[model samples]
Target: MSLFTNSNVTCPNCEAVVNMPAVGSVNADRRPDFRDAILDDSFQVTTCPNCHEAFRLAPLFNYLDVGHGQWLAGLPASRVVDWPEVEDDIDSVFQASFGANVPAAARDVADLLTVRVCFGWPAIREKIYLKGVGLDDVTVEMMKMDLMRRLKDAPFVQGTELRVGAVDDQAFQMVWIDAETEDVRQRFSAQRALYDAITAKPEAWAALRDKLSDGPFVDMQKLFLGQGRVAAE
Candidate 1:
């Protein structure tokens, strides 16, 4: 069932309060239109009536894709609390909704879904898009780190957004965007050999897997770097 509520929202542009749809939950298979809106980033956004300014209505929401057998709980990062418990609650919800058996690949509840402690909609949208392409977010970050290291002496600034645009068995294509300005810097390719190296290492895969149980913002770069540091020691 589709779950949402219309609430009064204050326009940041003109301060006129208006009612808008605050989506909290969605069963995508039943509500295909809602899923389309989410992927296109239109569901939580509303235009202000007084000033006609567009703004995001970022209430925490749960996205369940029945066809893909995936789910994501998106919460504001500021609401720091017991996330593992929150995940457990989501697990219970999933079981009640879908029954006891989950996919064999899903070894546990953490594997059953994704927990996104998001700063805003863009990050959440990107996560959804990445998963659609069968690329794990943690592994993609690892690739980004390798790209920066290879171009360490280049003129690029720090904090550029590394996004996977396409992937194949031989290579992964990425687009680099300036973090602050949100401008596309360039497009580049990262050898698939880099990705293979990480998945091949049991320790690295285990590091990412273990961190999934703790909380959100997996911090793949930090975890990957920590592994590298340990290896060098």
Candidate 2:
């Protein structure tokens, strides 16, 4: 049985209505979670290319999302899938379904989380500012604690201490630290929102500098200056 026989997809960015169908391979209901919903849909996945909003399975709204999930940035969004036309031609990774059979390189790609939004120059600049924090050994643990606390309310917040590298290093590496876990989507989403909020109002953000409490705002500066006590102090 299918979960969504007639579902609609709207661009989180353009708000454009997307017309697509969820064609499942196996059973959509038996698949467990929304993320798994698409995997079951051997033939269809809904996405908003304009904003990069993707619902691997139809009834994407049914996906286990906390709030303002991964696609909030709202641009350059799409979930590309590999479908096998021939029975024997199937890719082992997609066949495995649980990502257990993924090779080393592809496995690494799985750990990554992406966000896309068009905030224009100001938003972009704010993100750039946060990225300025250096991931030196001294503040690494603090960064971990900070990520943990901030994400405390966010269940399934990837339990790993994120590796936050320098700006140039961000492309292929996150330098801070690594605390891995299965739950992180929610925390990651929150971080992105916080980033957007701070970026939109830098002066107001600066005034609340003391409130960051390990959000990595002033902490980034501390990481840069080698000050270990607190980000504000």
Candidate 3:
């Protein structure tokens, strides 16, 4: 079941406080419109009654799409620096809800879910978009690593990210955007062959793949964020 709780929020534009329904969890299988809203970037948008300023709430909830084989913990962008701790918490939550702690019946459903921890809107949206388009996310992250090395003036920086804005058979539409503000810093296309090449040579990327897939936070950025969480045995 999808759950929402009314919470007070301060408007960024106006100093007015307003109450709104904040999502606690999303069951996309039951409410696909919620999924649609998320894809369209409209989920949890609220208008301040006092000043009528529009503001979006940072995602802080669990999203489950059984048919898509995805189970994600969506968190605020500010919390990404603490991913090690956050990943541990998400692991515990997944365990209680669907891992060993759950009944066998639930475990059957859990087996199909690809668990992930995403920070901010762009990060979470990229995960869902890649799944919907049948793209391998691990390879996609590998592509970003390659791009960082190849692009002479790539705008790689803190609080910004490279995400797949769209994709097709020929190429992936990529955007380097501010994770918090959703501002597009740059736009470019990556050929499908780049992803295909990486997919074809898994042996070369085995060690990096292990590190990226060590936790639910399978993003390449984790590599730059100091010594990350130790890989599970």
Give the local distance difference test score of model 3.
0.91
Compute each candidate's TM-score over C-alphas. 0.65, 0.20, 0.96
Candidate 1, residues 109-143, lDDT tens digits: the string is 43556554433454555667777777777766666
User: What is the clash count for each candidate, in the order shown?
Assistant: 0, 23, 0
Would you list the rank order by lDDT, best first? 3, 1, 2
Whichever of 1 and 2 has more lDDT, that candidate is 1
Better of 1 and 2 by TM-score: 1
lDDT (Cα, tens digit) per residue for candidate 3, span 1-233: 99999999999898788899999999999999998888888899999999988889999999999989999999998889999999999999999999886799999999999999999999999998888888878889998998888887888789989999999989989999998888899999988899999999999999989988988999998998866766669
TM-score of 3: 0.96
Q: Model 1 segments beyond 4 Å from truth?
A: 77-119, 145-193, 203-205, 212-233
Pairs in steric clash, model 1:
none
Worst lDDT run of 10 residues, candidate 3, spans 223-232
The C-alpha RMSD of each candidate to the native structure, in angstroms, is 6.5, 18.5, 1.6
> Per-residue CA lDDT of candidate 2, range 113-176, in tens?
1122211121222232233342222223234444556544433222222433223422322322
